[model samples]
Target: MNLFSEIRGLVLDALAQMQSDGALPEGLSFVNVAVEPPRDAAHGDMATNAAMVLAKPAKMKPRDIADVLAGKLATDERITSAEVAGPGFLNLRLAPAVWQGVLAAVLEKDTDYGRSAMGQGQKVNVEYVSANPTGPLHVGHTRGAVFGDALASLLAYSGHDVTREYYINDGGAQVDVLARSAYERYREANGLSPEIAEGLYPGDYLIPIGEALKEKYGDSLIDKPESEWLEELREFSTEAMMDLIRADLKALGVEMDVFFSEKSLYGTGRIEAALKSLTDKGLIYEGVLEPPKGKKPEDWEPREQTLFKSTEHGDDVDRPVKKSDGSWTYFAPDIAYHYDKVTRGFDALIDVFGADHGGYVKRMKAAVSALSDGTVSLDIKLTQLVKLWKNGEPFKMSKRAGNFVTLRDVVDQVGPDVTRFVMLTRKNDAPLDFDFDKVLEQSRENPVFYVQYAHARVMSVLRRAAEAGIAADDATLTEADLGKIDHASELTVAKKLAEWPRLVEIAARTNEPHRVAFYLYELAGDFHALWNKGNDETQLRFIQDGDVATSQSKIALARAVSVVISAGLGILGVTPAQEMR
Candidate 1:
């Protein structure tokens, strides 16, 4: 249950009653009123701006409104006390039974406790990790992957029908380069001295693709010209690289719901259709763009080109759709891809791009905005770079991935669970330094280990309770006399549990799954603190040797923690550790 929302409802009811009784002016809109946790817990359980928000509208002083509202809230059984802290903010103290009830709700709802209906099953498309199908995914793609996957899970948990999508960049000159590179590998497989050109992919990962080509073609096209095999090899090598990319993603526990090929947009009337839609809206036009601010005539020559009136939507400047030579610009296919998403009837779209693509964000949003006629919303999240550190030094490049470390390289050293959690330890837009040594150090500094340790500790308590024959299963715990859990330390954990539903809604609304990870870390810290406190206060111990009834009540609280932890980890695509290694 969302205690915060419930409390806010009570405050709103009090305000409505105040209006009815003429204690305040009528027709005062309570939309701006909010009830949330007080900034400092010492003040109260929750703080509301109901009085301050209504004072001016109600034509009364904030203190006068607060004084009356406080009396009204006092009549509610859930509110123990309501005091005006400062000028107008009302601090509320909830009854102890309210916190106890939160734990019971956690036990009752289990993994579904924090799930939200905020999205109302709206259709959403999340396109992410759309790396070119040229090589194995690198570290940058990993961050995008983790962020995108977690975001998709978060949206799904919040009741959105989310489609996880990957756009393949296979319709460009890069794939031709890939074909030429694979040809060299094929020659190498035929016992020839392959010329590893400077611009071609030189990674040894292509060796297997080369050998596979030899097995299929069997030297039939050994000396054929570029025209004879370029098309065939382009298709072949792109598929092979995609296969490798899929395997890499699988190793990291990522699977896309859709793999949209860039090639399909071309030669299929899709790009033309996308452009025509803009044309019909009078958005597409032939114009000359101004030369870039810092560029010289030698650097850039402005020419008349087919452009989209992106500025009309939100972009800083109009963007080109086609060049002076009548060839489509790089933005053309992307526009078509997003147009496809818009036409597919998604209510919202989210693109998880690398930080390097920051410049494209405004134009992409403009395109989607213009295409969807402002009906569908688009948010582009750029995941910043991740720097890998090992042994107090920058990690070296991977031989398998040629110039960069592959996603497999990181996953191999640390398991998928650790990889996912640590990747989200920082905001997606902030640079993250992932130290291999520090992540696996089994210390509190490592958030992944710390969260897992809390879950595992709860599991250990269950095992001990089971050994003591206290019947600590969920069924027994739900019926336990939770009033026995009256200690201050235990209540702190229950209060943290009460925030889960509110936290989920906030994180989902912000489209920031990193907030979920941060909450899990804080929750783990609270649980760990309570666990440690049990060490000094024998009565606070969960098992309470020889007292089955008191032990069941305490074990119920601990089990509730594991349930929420599992739900949070599930959103992050992390498996909650039942035992620490």
Candidate 2:
């Protein structure tokens, strides 16, 4: 149950009455009207802009409208008071039983409590961690992977049919580089002391690909020329790189629903089809783009070529689809890739890219918009850089991923759960510091442990209640007499618990999984505060020594906290610890 929505219904009902009674205009639209919790808790449970939004439209003063709406809202049984706040805002105070009922609702729904229908099962394609299939995934890709996967999960929980996709850059020069790199390793496996050229991949990861190539071809490709073995090696090397990438993602508990290859677009006429649609719409033309401001390339001579009029759709300039030499530009395949996604029947698309790909966002969004006739919405989230820290110093780099730390390196040090949770502790656009020393800490400073500890504490209570022969199953606990839970501290936790459903919708609406992490932190802090309060007041303790009825009622609250924590962690793809280790 969305309490905010329930209260919004009340506001609109009041406005309808005002219109019926002729106190307001006969034809006023409430599209801009909104009801939400005020920034400060003391302002009220929810505040509405009924007056502010309608004042000018109705040709009436805001206070005049708010005063009339307040009187109508006061008759709502759920609202204890309706007051006109500054400049026509209607602040509402719901009855204490309303908050109490919300907690009971959470207990009723259990793990499914916060699941939403906000998305209405819309099809959304989330493309993330589309790293070059040239080496193992690095730490930077880890953040994008976690954020994108969690976002896909969040969207699904909010009722969207989401497809987690990874676009493989397998059609470009990079795959050719992979083939050449593996050739060097293949020669090394033959004990030839192969020379590692300047442009070749020098990482030890290619050693396995070389060995695998041997096992498959058995030295048949050993003495072949570039043209003879390039295609075969490119295909083989890319598959091995993707295998390592998939394994790295699985280690961090990430999985994709689709792996789209750029190579497929090369021979499939998909690029021509996508650009043809644009050309039919007059979005494709032959043009020369202006040199970039202040730092034009030395070869900035104007040459007419096939270009997409991306500037009309907000790109900095018209983008080339084909170079003067007739080969497709790098962006040509990407546009076709996203066009392929749009044609797959997604109602919306979300691409999670590294911050370095920020310059590409506008053109990509433009492509999807053009391809889908502006019907499909594309939300591109760029995850910022991740700086690693260990033992109070910057974490060392990985030879596997060339210049950066690999995902396996991070997951190996702190395990998958910690790595995933820590990566999402910041917004996708906000740079994050992954400290190997801090994330493994058992204290509240570590969010993964803090949230997990709260779940473990609740489990501890349940185990104790079970050992004492107190029936604390959800069915029994839901029926417990919570009338005795009038303690201010206990009720404080109930208020926090009531925010779960609201928080989920908020996080999903914004595509911000970091909000979930922050919410869990706050929720755990509040639960911890209540637990610490039991030290001072004997009656505040969950177990009242010999009273099973009162203890069951109190333990019911603790059990509900665990239920919510477990569900929230589940959304984050983190397993709640049954006990602290």
Candidate 3:
């Protein structure tokens, strides 16, 4: 069904035949031979680097190889022309029936047409939005959540077994802080003036958690000692905050396959086990880390503490896994969590963190690398900041969140579909400016609307065809004579449609889901352009008055556009609009 792949296979077959006949040198590697869309449409349908890549290896000039390869490639039934351009790159033009066949293939396969087997069932663990389970998730966490979820879905579409995970920071002092913050609310629920003290959570969102605590514990525990209540309350409050977080993720349609607890690693000997694996490999030692260059850290003390020789594995400075007081350091639990993943038999681990956590990437990778003895790879993807815009200014802070815009605040304003698509319009490492006005604008300038409009317009055509008493059903459209689609514009769209399978492999190989968003935008644009061209040329119109057969063929093209749009939007976790409102 992939025309580009079919063409590439033909090219490889021709090269192999050349070697067998001694027309070219034997044992020449064709690994670098690629068939992809040329940068300029005027050049050809696809361009290949077979000749250029094999020239030096074969001990021949690029042009000499290109000339010989071109003579052999020109004989393929699908290849109408194979011309060497610019000293070795071969630009290929295919027969019109080739693109027509692609459109028919899309109709046959529907949305699953572009699904690829490139990942080969490798298990990839994606850890994202590991925000502290303290309160409502904010805008920064929103971006990371969307990016990680989309990337997981993209990898799954390309045949990777992806596990979406979140690591809770419940083992730290922050949850203790959350417990104390909720205690004040517990007192307030009993009709006492709650003291919102410094270093305590001041957000109004905790008011409900406090009220819930009173409903559960009432008057009996009101005057209890801190020693008796701290542990119980900490556990209760952390669970409550995680419930709030789960609700937020649900609001955005992000579901995690695992929610790992940092607390579990404590008292379970997991930290010791993780560090022992490193120590057994001579990567752990008791040493004082050299203070970061030219600056005194706030926690800098001359005392020797237990440290991991992280610098030996590529960190800037050796990191401590135990503090001076002999308690496990924050990095200890993280290392254990990752070691746990490695032990789970995952082939790769991808951690999605906020931009502020960029400094931790190197050490985290080093830990996984050393622990797995170079067998497993860890990729830490940092999602940069999302600047919110509304009323032509920044969407100001939320009192409920205490410091930033809660995920609910963003989703409630624009709905989940807009929020998800607009968040992915930028690269993961690049800052994205999301404007409330722009995302909702019903014009081509807005990619969110543009993509949906393309789908909705296709539905409009189907609806009209139905009203005209024409059979636009899949049964009819699937059997329509696509050769009747003869406009240059129609063929251009079919050619773009043929690139879907190729595009999926490219996006998965680079671990970049933004490419999917970008492709959807371009596809939507091309579709919109073709739709507009029908205004001047009635021959290209979706509905040909009084000719049901021709209308069915054009409707087949429109339905195929919907198939691709739905597939692309499914990967993004956004619903494709069937009717624009």
lDDT of 1 by residue, 196-312 (tens): 889999898999999999999988878899999999999999999999999999999999999999999989999999999999999999999997767667768768999999999
| Model 3 residue 228 CA deviation in Å | 1.8
- Please report how far candidate 2 places residue 156 from its true position, in Å: 0.2
Lowest lDDT block of 10, candidate 2 = 94-103
- Per-prediction RMSD in angstroms? 1.0, 1.6, 1.4
lDDT leader: 1
Off by over 4 Å in 2: none
Measured by TM-score, the strongest candidate is 1
Clashing pairs in 2: none
After superposition, the stretches of candidate 3 with alpha carbons farther than 4 Å from their true spots are: 296-301
Q: Can you give the TM-score per candidate against the true fold?
A: 0.99, 0.97, 0.97
TM-score order of candidates, best first? 1, 3, 2
C-alpha lDDT of all candidate models, in order: 0.94, 0.88, 0.90
lDDT, candidate 2, at 326: 96
lDDT value for candidate 2? 0.88
lDDT of 3 by residue, 322-423 (tens): 988988888999999999999999999999999988889889988999999989999888999999999999999998988889999999999999999998
Candidate 2 local Cα displacement, residue 196, angstroms: 1.0
